[model samples]
Each structure stands twice: as structure tokens, then as C-alpha cells.
Target chain A: MAATNLSERRLARFWSKYGFVLAVLVPILLWFSIFSFGPILYALYASLTNTHSLDPSRARFVGLDNYISLLDDRRFLASMSNVFRFVLVKGILNIVLSLGLALLLERLRRGRNFYLFFIFMPVVISQVAVAMLFLWLYDPRLGLINYLLSLVEIPPQSFIRSTAQAIYSVAIADVWKTYGYAAVIFLAGLLDIPQDYYEAAKVDGATRLQTLWRVTLPLLKNPLVLVMVLIVIDGVQHFTMVQVMTGGGPADSTLMPSILVYNYGLGANNYRMGYACAISFIMFVVIMAITVFQLRLFRSLYD
Target chain B: MTDISLDRRAGGSLPSGGAGADARIRLREQVIALVTHLLLVIFAFIAFGAMMWMVLASFKSASEIIAKPPTFLPEAPTLESYALILREQAFGRFFLNSIFVALPSVLLILFSSSIAGFVFAKFDFPAKEVIFTIILSTLMVPPAVTLLPLFRLVSRLGWADTYQALIIPVCVSAFGIFLLRQFMEGLPSELLDAGRIDGASNWWIYRHIVLPLSVSALSALAIFSFLANWDSYLWPLVIIYEEKMRTLPLGLAYLLGWSSRPRYDLFLTGAVITVVPVVVFYSFFQSRFVRGVTLTGLKY
Candidate 1:
């Protein structure tokens, strides 16, 4: 009886020490399992099977069929190419404009906050709202852009309607809304840079151009990498604004993989869950590869 | 510039040869400053002007909105479009739905993240590093990879048209947990030890000490998550079937296909309604919003 009492007390002591930790962690881990982790594993499994979204019980193991078929898929190839152009245009414009704005903001002694307030306003608003605003702005006949162009005797161009200009036009809209965010990141990095570096550069007879190239750009690497990776991830996974603007139209000129995922999985007469999952997995792989490549490149360049 | 005049005075007291070079350099600096401000003004104008123009257009009549060489200001400045959207498109309902969904989700995330963060910060346990790494790794997985399975899972649970469908999937943010963990780790452990010496339970110490101190980090998480939840589109578009269940962004997107042709009047007004509140919230907490970005390196 005394031995039994001692064992019971030991068990109670263990629970007292660990009870709170388990209480908090168990529920959180369970949530991640259900919501975050579960979906990932399920998607991976479903990618290998021909599972219909509406009726998953009828799923059959296709064993890499979905992955193999996407190789020659015209729509899939177009989406890959389209997203590449989107990221390119977005990255260049975003970096140039944001870095320039940051440099300018860094120069100001007063009114920095005032300028930043307005510039960063666009970053907080809804993507759909931005998309709506741009749709009207890009409207062919009655839009502001075409009207301004007409003042110079330039004929009205169909921005989203034409296949040639659609992707770039959409990309420009994305850049306009997002570049402010990159500007903020760059500004923080700029502010973190010691003023002594600029003084030293001046002392060495470095011109403004030399100072910018040799001192400023090299010091600004971390924020630059951060902003670039963000742009790629955002550009690849872009759906809402593009989906609202064009729905991947004008003969699929602006088709994105995310849209294809949605279209193939749920759109009318297309319940190819397995195919959509495969596309999603490919997108995942591409993002991971690019991000890893960027980190390595930046590390090598700076380190 | 004022600084140049001050420099001129200082240069006036210096040697004659140095004064000329000083004046010339100051003049060049003045020119650069002028050009910088000019470019910055243009940048600010372009950024702020587009949104301002949209606000003005919302007050325009349907006919005036489509007019050639759009008027810089509304000719009549009527409230008809706002009335039409709120009355006809059920945007009032969408606004309420956005609040109802966002408030609960944001609050839940704050609670979950802070408590979970507290555990990670203050407690010692087995597999902690492994668990935290796993959670952090989820940050790298694109939402596209999880979209189809989540959709199937939610639908299978028969949560297709419910508020729970939107709120629950997003209740616990991995970013929030990670952010709060970093913040909470900086908190003093002595206070907790003092409480524990006084025979306080973990929950009591968390409630009285950790939470009160974590208001700043919690506020940052609150704003970003609220903005994110308010702005979410794809998941709602996938799940919500009922008009009454639509969030503001989803409702605003539907305005595009609401009619045969684009209704700029209603679209602009709906957008204004959707954007104004968030803008107002952001303006009040501008520094926190910026700090949140720096801390997390993310924008919603």
C-alpha cells in the first residue's frame, strides 16, 4: 500500500510539471496537423491518383500519369512562360522604382514620413479593389490611359483585351500596387546603414555614382534579396487580381498556374483534381528551387 | 535651401578661394535636393492620385463615369452609386460579413499565437526545435499546394457555406506563432519565476504578466491578420456559395460579372467602401503597420 502511494505521487508530480506545456502544445500541434500539414500530405497523395474533386472515393492510382501528361500540356507550358515574364517585369520595375524611391527618401531631412504615408497607402488596400481600379484605368475606349494617349494622337490600345499587351499590362498593375512595400523594406535597410560609410566614401574621393555602386548597393543586399524573393513568390502564386482582371483570357495569354489549378479542379466539366494537384505541386517545386537558388546566389555574392 | 544660406555665411568667413568652391558645391547640392523633392512629389502624387481619383469617381453618376476624357472631379457628385450598391448588391451584408469573419479570426489568432508563443518562449520540452522547425517550414509551402486538398476537406466536412469554413482554416497563423515567439523570448523570465514562486499557475502568469507585456506584438499581429482576412479572396470564391456569406473582396469581384457590361460607377463605389475602412485603420496605426512589415518581412 505504501509503495502504491509513492508511485501515484510520482505520477502526479510528472503531470504537474508537464501538464501546461502539453495543454497548449497538443491543441496547436493538432491544429497544424489538421489545417496546415494534413492538406499538404493529402495533396501529395492525390497528385499520384486520378481523383475527382467532387467524388474522391472513385480515385484510382495513376502513378505519375498527371506529372507526365503536364510535360506536353499546351496550357501548362503557356502558364510557365507567362509567369516567367510576369516575374521578370515585376522584379525589374519593382526593384528600380523602390530602390530609387528609397534613395530619394533617405536624402530628405523633412517630409519623409509625409511622402512615405501616401506612397505606402496602396500596399494596405484590397487586391480586388486595386484590380477594379486598374480595370477601369486599362479600359480600351473610355479609360483614363487611352484618353491620355489620344492627346498625343496615339490610337487607343486594348490593354487587357489584346493578347500581346495583356500580361505586361497586368504585371504593371501588380507592380504599381506592390512596389511601395519593397520601398518600405529598402528604406528600413537604408536607415540601418551607418552614415559613416557614406562619409568614408566621400573622404576617399568617390563620386555619387561610385558611392551608389560600390557602397550603397553592396550594403543593401539583404533587403534586395528579401524583396526579390517576395516578388517571385508573389508573382508565381498571383491569382486574385489577374483572375479578376482577365480570367486568363485573350487566348490564355495571361494564364497562371494557380488559375489552372482552380479551373481544372472546379470549373465546369473539369473536375480533374489529380491534374490540378500536380500543377500545384510543380508550382511548389519551382518556387522552392528558385528561392533556394536566390539564397545561394546572394550568399555567394556577399559572403 | 536654408542649409545653403547657412553654409554661405560660414563660407563668407572662410578664405576667398575656398568660398568659391564651397558656394559652387552648395549650389550643386541645392539643385540635387530640388530635383529629388520634385521626383518624390511625382511619386507620391501617382501613388495617392489613383486612389483619390477612384474616390471621386465613386461619387459620379453612371453616365458621367463613362464620359470621354474623364472629369477630374464629379460634375454632380451624387450619392446614387453608393446607394445602389448598398441597397441592390447587398454590399452592406458583405461589409458585415467581412467584419464578423475578420474580428473572430484575428482575435483567435492573437490568442492562439500568444499562448503558443508563450509556451515556446517560457517552457522547456522535448522535440521543441523539431516542432518549431516544422511549423516554420509551413511558411515556405505555397498556398496553391494546399488549395485543392483544403477545399476537399472543408467540403467534406459540409462547411462549404459557413463562417466557420473561412474562420477555422486560418485561425492559427504559423507566421503569427513565429512572430510572437520571437517577441516573447525577449520578455524577462524573472517575472514569471517570481509568479511561480508565489504559487501561481502557468495560465495565471500568462494572463497577468505575459499578456500585458505582449500587447505591442499582439497589436502588430492583429492588424496584419485582420487586413489579410479582410482581403482574402480565393478561398472564399472556392467555398462560399451563398450571397449572404460573401466577404467584401469576393463581393466586389462579383461586381465585374454582375451585369453584361462593366459598371464603373458601382465597381468604384464598392471598391471605395471596401478600401476606406482599412485605409482609415492603417492611417491611425501607420508606424505599427510599418514596424510589422520590418519585424515579419511580410505585407498582407
Candidate 2:
């Protein structure tokens, strides 16, 4: 009887201490259940189905029709190419610009805060607003960019209207809006470098260029890798700017994978939900593979 | 540039009798400083100039905006566009919707994430490592992966056009919990022990000791949460169908899509209206914002 009482007391104490944590866990579990885990399961099921989002009751188990069809779709192929271009070109540009700005800002002794504040302003602004702003800025007739170009006797070029230039133009706008964030992260890494290293380099007659290449670049590897991975992920998942600015227009030149998913799943054609789900899954796998590979590569670099 | 050169020249003259070598070094240093400042200033001007242009264009008459050379400042600046946006477009309604949706979502994220963070930071429970790892692993998953599945779930629950659909699914943030947990773990354990010795309960310790000490982290999390929800586009775009239920970003997108021929002033005015609250909020919480990003970088 005494042993039973002791066990009961122990159980009561555990419940009393942990009851709140259990309560907290319930909502999180439900969130994962309904949103994260539930969707993933549903997406898997949908990927195997012939169901459209508009008419869910009509869904039929078609066994990989969507996946096989995706391989043959030309637009999907184009979007895939677009993603690669964006990931490589825009991603690299954003990193370089951000790192360059961070270095310049670090060298300054005065007005650092002012410059930091100005640079960071774009990051906090709504992407939709930035999109709209860039739309006006990219206006072929009255836009600032074209107007500036015309000052040096250059002819007006229809930036968003041209098939060749639309993707690059959209990428430029995105870089302007987002590279500030990369700069912020890089600045933090720059600050983390001990002043002693710079002093040591200077004492050894290292020039600014040499010190940057040997000391700063080597120490900045982790942040650079982090920013690169983030930019790639962000570039792949980008939607608002493409959606608002060009609507993947001028012969589908700027159609990103996310934009394709949105158009199929939610746009005017009504629910190609299953196809959308398949695309999302593919995107998920691609992003996961890239992230894992990059992380491993970075880990090896550190080692 | 001239001032820098002068300073360099004076320093060079005092340093050595070999004036030629010193002077050349000084000249090179001054030239580099001049070029660096010029480049930075030019970029700064471009950035600030673009923002200023947006503000000015929002006040210009439609024709003035499209005029040759595009008027630098509006000839007759008017509140007509602002008035039209607020009255005809009902941006006021959309603004209120954004506030109502974002504020509650931010509060929920902060409260729930803080509790979860406390557990992860202070406790040694069963499967702690596994649970923490699961939470961290979710960070690797792209948000797009959840879009279709979430839509299906929300539709099934008949929450497609409701605030619950907008707020509930996003209220529990893994990143928030992770950030706060990292911060909380850095706090000394002696304080919690002292509180226990004084017969204070865990809840009491959390309220009195932990919460106060974690104010900086909490504030940082708050700013991030607010900005994120305020600027959220895609999920809200997918979920909320009604005009009355739309957030700011979606509302702006709708306005852009509403007119066949886009009105520069009206669209820009809407953009400005959407941007102001966030800029104000950020400026007020600037220190926390910097601290948050910096801390995350250091840890990651």
C-alpha cells in the first residue's frame, strides 16, 4: 500500500510540472498535423491522382500521370531552365554586391549607421510594394532607368516587353530589394573578425587587396556560404515580383517554378491541384537536395 | 577629398625627411579614400533617390508623371490620389484588415514560441535532443512544399476565407522558438535556482525572472514577426478570397490588377501607404532588429 502511494505521488508531481508544456505541445502538434504533415501526405496522395483543385470530388487515382506528364511539358522545362539561371546568375550577383557593400561600409569611420539604415530600408519594405515600385521604375517610357540611359544618347528599350531581357530585368529588381539583407548578415560576420587579424596583416606589410583576399575572405567563408544558400532558396521560391511585374509574360520568359505552381493551382484556369502538388514536391526535393549538399560541402570546408 | 589630402600631407611632412616617398604614400591613400567615398555616396544617392522619386510621383498628376523628362517634383502636388485610394479603393479597410490579422498572429507567435523556447532551453526532458532536432529540421523545408497541402486542409475545414485560416496555421513558428531558445540557454542557471530556493514555481520564475531578462530577444522576435506577417503575400493570396479579408500586400496586388491601364500615382500611393507603417515600426525597433539578425548569424 505504501509503495502504491509513493508511485502515485511521483506521477502527480510529474503531471503538475509538465502539464503546461504538454498544453503548448498540443497546438504545435495540431499545426504540424493540419498544415505541415497533413499537407505533405495530401500532396503525395494528390501527386498520384488526376484530381483538380477546382473540382476535388472528381479526383481519380491515376498512378503517376502528373509526374510523367510534367517531364513532357515544355513550360515546365522552360521554368526549370529559368530556375537554374536565377539560381546561378542572380544568386551570385546578390552575394557579390552584398559582400562588396559590407566591405565598403566596414572601411568607413563616419556615417556608418546612416548608411546601414538606408541600405536596410528596402529589406523591411513589402515585396509587393517593391514590385510595384520597380514596375514604375521599369516603365519603358517614363521609368527612371530608361530615362537615365537616354541621357547618354542611348535609345529607349522595352525592358519588360522583350523576351530576352525580362528575366534579367526582374532579377535585377529582386537583387536591389533583397541584397541589403545579405549585406546585413555579411556585416555581422565582418564584425565578428577580431581586429587583431587586421593589425597583424598590416604589421606584415599586407596591402588592402591582399588582406581582403587572404584574411577577410577566408574568415568570411561561413557567412558567404550561408548567404549563398539563402539567396538560392529565396530565388527559387520567389513569386510576388514575377507575379506582379511581368506575370511571367513576353513569351513566358520570367516564369519561375513558384509562379508556375501558383498559376496552375490558384490562377484563372482553376484547380490543377494535383499537378500543383507534384510540382511542389519536386521543388521540395530539389531544394532539400541542394541544401543538404551545400551544408555537407560547407562542413567539409570547415573541417 | 581635398580635406583628406590636406590631412595626409600634414601627417606626411611630420613623419620623415624623405618627403617624396611619404608624399606619394599619402597621395595614394587620399586617392583611395576619395574613390571609396565617391562610390558609396553615389550608391546611397541612387537608393534614397529612388525612394524619394516614389514619394514625389505619388503626389503628381497622372500626366505630370508621364511627362517628358518626368517631373522631378510634382507641379501641383495634390492629395487627390491618396484621397481616391482611401475612399474609392477602400485601402483603409485593407489596412485595418492587415493590422487585425498581423497583430494577433505576432502576439500568438511570441507567446507560444516563448513557452516552447523555455522548455527547450531550461528543461531536460525525454527525447529532448530528438524533439529539438525535429524542430530544427523543419527549417530546411521550403514553405512552398506546404502550400498545396495547407490549402487542401484549410478548404476541408471550411476556413478558406476566414482569419483563422490566415493566423492559426502560422502562429507556431519554429524559427522564433529556435532563436529564443538559443538566447535563453545563454542565461545563467543560478537565477532559476535561486528562485526555486525561494519557493517560487516555474511559472513564477518564467514571469518574474526569465521574461524580464529576455526582453531584448522578445523585442527582436516581435519586430521580425510583425514585419513578416505584415509583408506576407502568397499564403494570404491563396487563402483569403474576399476583398474584406485581404492583407495589405494582397490588397496592393488587387489594386494593381484592378485597373486595365495602371495609374502610376494611385498605385504608388497605395505602395507608399503600405510601406509607411513598416518603416515607422522598424525605425522604432531598429536596435532590436539589428540585434536579432546579428544574434541569429552568430549562432547559425
Best by DockQ: 1
Candidate 1: where are CA atoms >4 Å away?
B1-21
lDDT of 2 by residue, B1-300 (tens): 000110111211222225466677888767877887877777677666777788898898878878887788899998888998888888998999899899899999888788888888997767878877877767666676678778877888899889889899888888888887888898899999999899997888888998898887787778878878888888998899888888889989988778788788787998999999988877876655655666554221
In CAPRI terms, model 1 is classed as acceptable
Q: Per-residue lDDT for A16-85 in model 2, tens only?
A: 8776667667677677676666777787888899777766888889888998999998888888888788
lDDT comparing candidate 2 with the true structure: 0.80
lDDT of 1 by residue, A202-248 (tens): 78999989999999999999889999999988999999999999999
| iRMS, all models | 6.2, 6.5
CAPRI band for model 2: acceptable
State the lDDT of candidate 1 residue by residue for B1-300, as single tens digits: 000110111111211235457677777877988999999999999999999999999999999999976899999989999999988899999999999999999999999999999999989888999999999899888888899899999999999999999999999999898888988898999999999999999999999999999988888789889888988999999999999999999999999888999999999999999999999998998877766676667535
Model 1 pairs whose backbones collide: none
Highest lDDT model number: 1
